[model samples]
Target: MKTFIIRSFIGIFFGGFLAVLITNLTIIFGGLEIIDGPLFVKNSIGSILCGWFFTVSPLYFEKRNLKLSQQTILHFLTVTSLYLILALTIGWIPFTIINILLTLVISIFVYTIFWVAFYLYFKNQARKLNDCLKRL
Candidate 1:
């Protein structure tokens, strides 16, 4: 739990940094003016909240004895749904049908890659451990 909180803080810090950078670019290119300073503050808070939400949501559904695939799917769905809802609510993304489909596909692809990488890594470690035990 301590590690989770620490990592969440780190993620929020980085997310806030990225939010500022992106906001500046949009302001320049999109000619979007921030009429109030509170907009910037709100963006920062939103980024942090979104990051923390994604980081922590899967933990609530995690089961120790579950299959890796199940865990990965659960995490992926939780993060993707939260991200989509938040993006739509904050007007970060338009809620067009094509845009929604494209965004969901991209998110699933990215999350599957992340989870599969970890799955393969842990599977290899377990295999090695089992082989070692057989030699004992």
Candidate 2:
């Protein structure tokens, strides 16, 4: 799909930009040196893929004629699990219970907020369309 590809490219671009920014910020704030290593390349690829995944996964539920609550639950379950897996694999989060739990909580909260915002935005658009149609 053209829309999917275009969105994926945009997502990866911004995600990579943020990844570089955050890496530099950590080097500055955390007093860490930038390492030009294979891991860096790996992380760069992982970050791009993660961004693409997040952009597309939620739309799986969005394309269906599901209730808002259903979409929220499905998106949370799918996105959070994938996010945790991707993050842990990329060494973004340590493989420990505390880190895992925190990642899970934070991922859920963030995606929930995202879903709610989009849901409300589309609902408002629908309302405006309906109002227009009534005058036809």
Candidate 3:
């Protein structure tokens, strides 16, 4: 319980931080400037919630009964849905077909990048562990 609380707080902090960072980046690069206070606050809160969900959703992977593929798919869907909804609500993305598709494509690309990076990292870790076991 204590661990969970700590993890949740960490997740929220990262979420809020990332939200602000991204917003600033968008303002700098995306241009069309001028974000009012209310909009910023709303977007920040939405992003924090999204981040919290992203963090805790991985707990689903701990279900050893589910195959890795199943867990990955479930996590992807859960996180993507929350992100898309928040993106739309916060007006970070407009409600047009092309915009929606583009957002999804970008999201999928980013997710794939992280997924592959983690996969390679863990695969390397497992190989190192196996090598150590063999030596022992």
Highest-scoring model, TM-score? 3
Model 2 clash tally, residue pairs:
0
lDDT of 3 by residue, 11-67 (tens): 899989998898899889989469878877887898788778878888767889999
Q: Which digits, one per residue and each the tens of the lDDT, describe model 1 over residues 57-101?
A: 667445788776677777777788888888887777798998899
Hey, what RMSD does candidate 3 come out at? 3.0
Q: Which sections of candidate 2 miss by over 4 Å?
A: 23-34, 65-67
Best by lDDT: 3
Model 2: per-residue Cα lDDT over 1-136, one tens digit each: 8778887998799779877887788789999776767877778788888788778766766466888677777767877787788889889899999999988788777766876788799999999999999999
Flag clash pairs in model 1.
none
lDDT of each: 0.79, 0.80, 0.86
Q: Predictions ranked by TM-score, top down?
A: 3, 2, 1
Best first by lDDT, ranked: 3, 2, 1
Which ten residues in a row are the worst by lDDT in model 3?
1-10
Candidate 2, residue 46: Cα displacement in angstroms equals 2.2
